[model samples]
Target: MDVVVIETRPLGDRSYLVHDGEVALVIDPQRDTDRVEAAAAEADVRITHVAETHLHNDYLTGGLILARAHGAEYLVSANDDVAFDRTPMADGGTVQVGRLTVKAVATPGHTHHHLSYVVSDGEDQAVFSGGSLLYGSVGRTDLVSDEDTEDLTRAQYSSVRRLAAEAQPDAALYPTHGFGSFCSSGPASSARSSTVAEQQESNHAFTDADEDHFVRELINNLTAYPSYYAHMAPANRQGPGPADLTVPESVDPAELSRRLADGEWVVDLRHRVAFASRHLQGSVSFEYGRGSSFTAYLGWVLPWNQKMTLVGSEEDIEKAIRDLSRIGIDSPDAALGTDPSALAPGTAVVHYPRVGWAEMLHGRSAGDVVLDVRRTDEYDAGHVAGAVNVPLHELLGRMAEVPAGTVWVHCATGYRSGVAASLLQRAGRQVVHVDAKYGPS
Candidate 1:
């Protein structure tokens, strides 16, 4: 048996393609089925089974459509209250795929009905741990509900132990979350691969035997997750269809201006520096390129189901469409170009000055406000002295609270700051983007 990883880096998750020469089983697939199809085609294996670890709270699952298209069985936990038909996989149940055997192990905690699949070829075995046993940590327990957090945290501790006890000592460990994913409770091991034995030696869940201490530590360390996660489980439960990757209708300068005038979202997908130099007056900066958390941040900042327009090069716009579709944002109108004058003729194009922490510190004015747009937890850890804290996620609703001044906005690595600066500029604040990594200067 061979296990292939399908990485979705923007969401910091992975889906797997497990095959036994002729047949394949896909676990925790994202909404885009083409990626999975391409992988299966390359491997020259027939997809005979598609399994979901749980009702995902990150991205919509492609398991349902992928299964239907290939005439494969769709496997979901029997305990979940989903709307569609599926081959209910109860704990200890087994499914055979050619020479491989898949056994469902009920490992609740990420969700109440979460299951980990242990696949074996009668000799070597691998565990698809889903959200349970991650590299150095596990999935966050607070996503379920505040009322259930304590119970789930305790359950997570037990679940990790249960999976470790049941699986072979050397079983290859694979997880769906924990590669810089918000789903993970804390930082994951950077090692490329891990096994049950290695995790047993290193993973905190295993190293800390006292369940009470483990539960408290995990809950206390839990930080804020993306605002868009609330819609994922509900959408997955309803069995969403394939993503709409069709290129949005191209809009002219007049239409783009009208959308901007109507207060519709006009996202500019340019480099942060380029966007800071010149952009459409009312356009919001959500740079779509390397090193940018384009999809996650955009999905988090934008109101759910809001009709929006994209402004960028054709390549960026195309990729942005695909990225947005993964988070259930589809069919957005687009305007192709970087030139603000060409894209929104005769409108007031704007620019903001960008600086590093040292430059801002050296050139400080008494009236200049240092605004930290990182999360509350990040602000608590350490931040610029006297920097006002308004997490990027909460900034939209609490704009009035930001003290009136020439705002110098910053974040850990300038991504959130770029977005915050653009929003503040659009709102008519005199803003400067501190486009540099945060550190002691």
Candidate 2:
């Protein structure tokens, strides 16, 4: 058996294409099904099945659409009260595709109906642990509901133990979460690969003998996830349609000006340094590039379903649209290019100063405010002395709380502070972006 890992790095998740050379099965695919199809084609395998471990809370699943397109069986947990039809899989149920035998194991943790798939040929086996039994941690159980958090966390502990007990020690452990996804409850191991034995030897689920302590620790450590996550499960339950990755109609200088004047979300996708150097007066900076979480943070901060306009080159806009679509933010309008003044004629182009930690520290004054735009938990862990905290996700709604002063904003990394700086600038506040890592100078 051969497995191909399809990584969606922007969201920090992985989907798998498992095959026995001729027939393949896709596990936990994202909304963009083209990537799965492309992987199948490249491997010279026919996709015979598409399976979802649960109704995901992170991104829309492409299982239904991919199954229909390939004439393959779509498998979902039998207990899920979804609107669409699916091959309902019960615990201990089995299916065969070519030489591979797939067994469904009931592992309710991340969600009540979650299942982990065990796929094996005659000699080799692998586990497709969608949200259960991660590399070093387990999927966050709070996504189900606030009321069910404790109960599900207990179940999560049991579920991971069960996976470790049932699967062979040598079997390859492939989890869909825990690869830098918010779905992970704790710090996940950075190891590229792990086995059941490796997990049993070091995973907290096994090392921590006290279940009560385990549950409490897991619950307490859970941090704030993206605000857009609340929409994913509902959309998945209704069976979302294909993602429209096509670029929206271009807005000329006049139309762009009108959108900006009318208070529409015109997002500028450039380097934060470039955005700070020069940008449209009202356009917000959500720089789209490597290591920048343009999709998640933008979707989180922006009002849900708000009509947004992108400002960047055609390539950047296209990439931004695709990333946004994965989180169900689709068909956003675009203004193609980086020159802020040219994009909106007669409108004021704005600029802000970006400083490092040293500059921010040395230039501190009695009236100047240091705004820490990280999450509450992140701020609680450590922060700049006397820095006022209003997380980036909550900044839009609580802008009034920010003190009157020249604000110097910073996050653990500068990506979020860059965004915060732009928002502050848009709101007519004097701002300096601390565009550097947070630590000793």
Candidate 3:
């Protein structure tokens, strides 16, 4: 038997391909299905089954696509209760691919229908635990209902314990997610797979911690989930309908401005601090730092047909595009410094060292209304006095709230404020962006 683990790095998602001589089975495939197909072809085996441990809230599962392309059976947990066109798997039920026997194990803490699969090669067994367990952490229970939190957490505890006790101490452990993923806490390293003996001694949730403490730590450290989750749950439940997996050509900034003027959405894909410092005035700011959930949130909050532009450093372009594609938002145009057409015929743009006492006072008296697009918390922490707070995330929704005519917007740095200025100009509002020293230019 041969087992290959495919790691979608920078994203920290893991998928597995298990094969014997004639048939193969894939577990938790990523959105890119070509690689899986190539691997199967290279090994001279037919893919017989595609399995999803749970409905994912991060990236769209490639199970349906892989199943259709290869004419394989798509298996998901029967307990999931979501409508999907696949064979429903129950605990103890088994599927076979050559010498491999795959058994479903219900592990529902991350979600009500979550399943962990136990793979046996006649003599040895390995568990594809999914989100139920990771190297240093367990799957978060808050992705689902509060009513199921306790039940799911309890179920997870037992499931991990069962795997630790029953599966061979040497059986390899493979999970769908690792560190840097919102699904699990801690670093994703080769340490992800451990022997039962190692887990018994080092896994916190498995040993030193109780259910209540486990739940408390998870909930307390939980960052704000991407707003897209609410939508992704239902979308995944129904199965991600057909989508073209091609990356679109990069777009020009001027064209992006035209789209925004026509009421299309513009997204600033920078970090929170960069976005807060300065951004396209009316553009929506969604940080990728939050996780792949950024795509999901944009899907729910922004209109599907809305044209979009990306504003960030060159390094972020590929990731920004990939994340957007995960949620079905593709083909975003790249942003340039300023949209020339959006600017007035001769509107002057100014640069500043910082929104210091002197800069703010001078800019304000010079008919520039200082705009603070940072979050409420940031604004309260001593911003240039009198600057109005309209966080970048809320900018588009609150366009009417900002006073019209000759506005000077600034964030902690100049990058986001510049993004904000471009957005305002696209909206046909007169504005000059202040590239303060403290912010990105």
> Per-residue CA lDDT of candidate 2, range 108-190, in tens?
99999899998899888899998999998999999988999999999999998787676788999999988778888876898
Assess every candidate by TM-score: 0.98, 0.98, 0.71
Q: Candidate 3 on 1-441: residue-level lDDT in tens?
A: 787777765455788898886899999987667768888888888999999999887777778888988889999887666665788998778998789989887777787777888888988788788898777667777778767766777777777787666577877788887655667742234574675566666776677467777666656565444455665667777767544544445455555646655666667676544544444445655666533345544554455556677666555666667656665565676663333224222322222122443455564655557778766666776777667888765666788888865777877655556556655665667665565554321
Pairs of residues clashing in candidate 2 = none
Candidate rank order under lDDT: 2, 1, 3
On a 0 to 1 TM-score scale, where does candidate 2 land against the true structure?
A: 0.98
Candidates 2 and 3 compared by TM-score, better number: 2
| Model with the higher lDDT, candidate 1 or 3 | 1
Task: Kindly report which residue stretches of model 3 are placed more than 4 angstroms away from their true locations once superposed.
Answer: 185-192, 247-255, 267-305, 310-322, 330-441
Worst 10 residues of 1 by lDDT: 184-193
User: What is the Å distance of residue 322 in model 2 from its true position?
Assistant: 0.9
How do the residues 137-205 of candidate 1 rate in per-residue lDDT, one tens digit apiece?
Answer: 999899989999999888898898888887999999999998878899955787778999999999999
